[model samples]
Target: MLWPNATRVLSKMGLLARLAAHCDSNTHFLVRTSSGKVLMKIALGDFDVPAICVRRADLLAALLSALPSEQILLGHEFRHLEQSGERVRIHFADGTSKEHDAVIGADGIRSRVRQTLFGKSDPIYRGYLIWRGVARYEGNAIEPGANSESWGAGKRFGILAIGEGKFTWYATLNTLADHSDSPDGRKSEIQKEFAGWHAPISNLVDATPDEEILKHLAYDNIPLRRWGVGRVTLLGDAAHPCTPNLGQGGCMALEDALVLAKCIVNHNSIQAGLRRYGSLRYSRTRHIQQRSLLMGHIGQWKNPLVVGGRRVVTNLLPARIFEHNLRRVYSYELPGS
Candidate 1:
C-alpha cells in the first residue's frame, strides 16, 4: 500500500503516471468488526495526494523500469562485507566480490549486511502470522477505491482493491512462532481461521489459487540505536522493521530513499551523509515502529469487553482527530521541497 506521502515522492521522481496506471487510487479507509459493523471511516481523499494500492510485483516492475537494466545485478545474494578505510567490499554467496565507496543495506528484515555491520540478531516475532494473496473478483461485493480491514478476536483481515478486478487480501491471526502448514494446506488454514468473517473475504480466498497464497510469521526488530558505521549504513526494514498494522513498511522505505539521497548530496563526505541520514530518520521511524506495534496489539484484542470498548472509543473519536493523524503521516514532504 502506497500512502499519499510515498506517492508524492514517486510523483517528484516522475514515476507516478506509470505506477498509477497499474494501481487503484484509494479514497476511503474503513475499519470494521468481523461481522461487518463499521467502527470508523477515514476519507483519504481529503489529502492532496491520494493513496494507491498495487501489487508488490507491479510496483517493483514500475520502479525497475525507471532504472537502467544493466545497473541492476540479478541473482547476487549478499553473504558478508568487509570495510576498509574508505571503501567497503561486498561478498556474495556466489563467491563474487565488489568494492564500492559506500554500501546501503536495503536488503530487508533478515539483512545480511546489517548482521555484518551490527551483530546478528533475530527479529522479534509479534505473536502473529500473516497470509497474503491476490485474487480476481468481478462481483461488486467490495466498493471501488475503498480499503477495509475487518477485526475479529485475535484475527484481522484486510482487503485492498488493486485495480483491474484484482484485490489483495491479508489475514492475520495470533499464533506461536515458526508455525508451518502441511503441503498445500495454507489456503485451507486461512479459510478456516477466517471462516465466519464478512463477505468478499471468503470470496477472495476462494478465487485465489492455493499456490498463489503466501504465508509468513510477522516479525520486526526493535528500533536500532544506530543505523550504520563508517561507509556502511542501513535503510528500510534493515534499519527498522515494523508490523504491517500501519501499512507503512514499504512507505517508510520509500521515504528513506528520498531523504538519504538528499542528505548525501547536501553533505560533504559519504560518512557525514550516512550519519545525517540515520539521524534524520531515527525519530520518525522510531515513532512509527512504536505506533504500529501498539495498533497491532489493539487490533488483536480477543476479549469481548475490550473489543467492544475499543470499537466504542474509535467510533466516538472525532473524525478530525483521525484526519489530523493521517495528515501527519501523509503530508510528509522531502527536505527543501
Candidate 2:
C-alpha cells in the first residue's frame, strides 16, 4: 500500500510522531508452533521496512480530524444510488440525497454502497472466525519489534505490540459460519479454545477486558469481474475484500485510496479516472487477495502431519527467501513515488 502519502499527511498535521510513539515498530515476523517453538523468524529489519501498527479507529479519527470540518460529513447511512447523465446520485436512508461527478464506495465488507452498485452481492465466508483484542501487559511482555504468530491444528494465535505495554492479539479458529456468538460468549469460547496453548497466548486472553474483545467471521469477495460501472465506482474492501491472513487488507485499501486519487487528478474525465484506477488496481489487489486466501488455508491446516510438514518446510527455507517474499509486498510504491 502507498503509505508515504499517509505519512506525509500525518506529518504535515504533526501527528505522525505521536502515532509512531504509540505504535510498535516490530522488526521481526516470527512463525511458531503451538508448543512455542519458532519455526521461522524473518528479520524484517534487514528489509529496512518500517512496520507501523495502529488501532484502525485511532488512525481514522486522526485522519478525519485532519480534514476540514466543512468538507466532512459526520453520520449518514447510505441507502441507494442512481446515475443520471455524467453524475451519480446517492440517497441516504433518511431521504436526503446528494450528487457527485463520481461515487467511490468505501462502505466496507457489508457495504450498502457496494450492493447499490453490484446488486446485493454477499461476501464468501472462509470457514473460520477470528477473535481480536488488546491487552495491557507489563514491560516488554510482547517485546517491541517482535511480532509472532503461532499456528496450531485448525487454529492460530498472533501477538504484536501496538503500543507501550500494550499488545494487540488475535486468535483464529475453524468454525461453522455465523456462530451468532455474543461478546461474552466469544470471550469464553476463545479462552477455552486456546487454553492449552503456550504462555502469553493464554495470558493475553485472560488479561483482555470483556468489552474490548471483538469477534468476527472471516469473509472475502470473490475477485470482482469489475470494480466500477459508470460514474459510480468502488474503493477499499468495497472493491476487493480479502481474508486477513496476509495482514494486508487495510494496507491494500490505503493503496487504493492513493492510486484512486492520483488517477482522478491525472485523468481528463471522471470516467477515464475510474477506468485508470481500476486498471491499475485490479491485478495487484486480486493477486494479494488470492495470496491471502492461500496463506489462510495453509495456516489453518488441521492435520498434524501436514502442519508438521509446513513447519519443517518453513524452517528449512533460508531467511533470504522469506525476506524476498516480504520485499515483494512491502517494496511496492505508488507509480512514481
lDDT of each: 0.87, 0.80
Top-scoring candidate (TM-score) = 1
With candidate 2 superimposed using the best TM-score fit, by how many Å does residue 315's alpha carbon deviate from the native?
2.1
Best by lDDT: 1
lDDT of 1 by residue, 230-301 (tens): 999999999999998889999999999999988888888999999989988898899889989998999888
What is candidate 2's lDDT per residue for 219-270, written digit by digit as tens? 9988886889899788889989999988888878877877888888998898
TM-score of each: 0.95, 0.91
TM-score of 1: 0.95
State the displacement of the C-alpha of residue 61, model 1, in Å, after optimal TM-score superposition: 1.3
What's the distance in Å from true for residue 52, model 2?
1.5
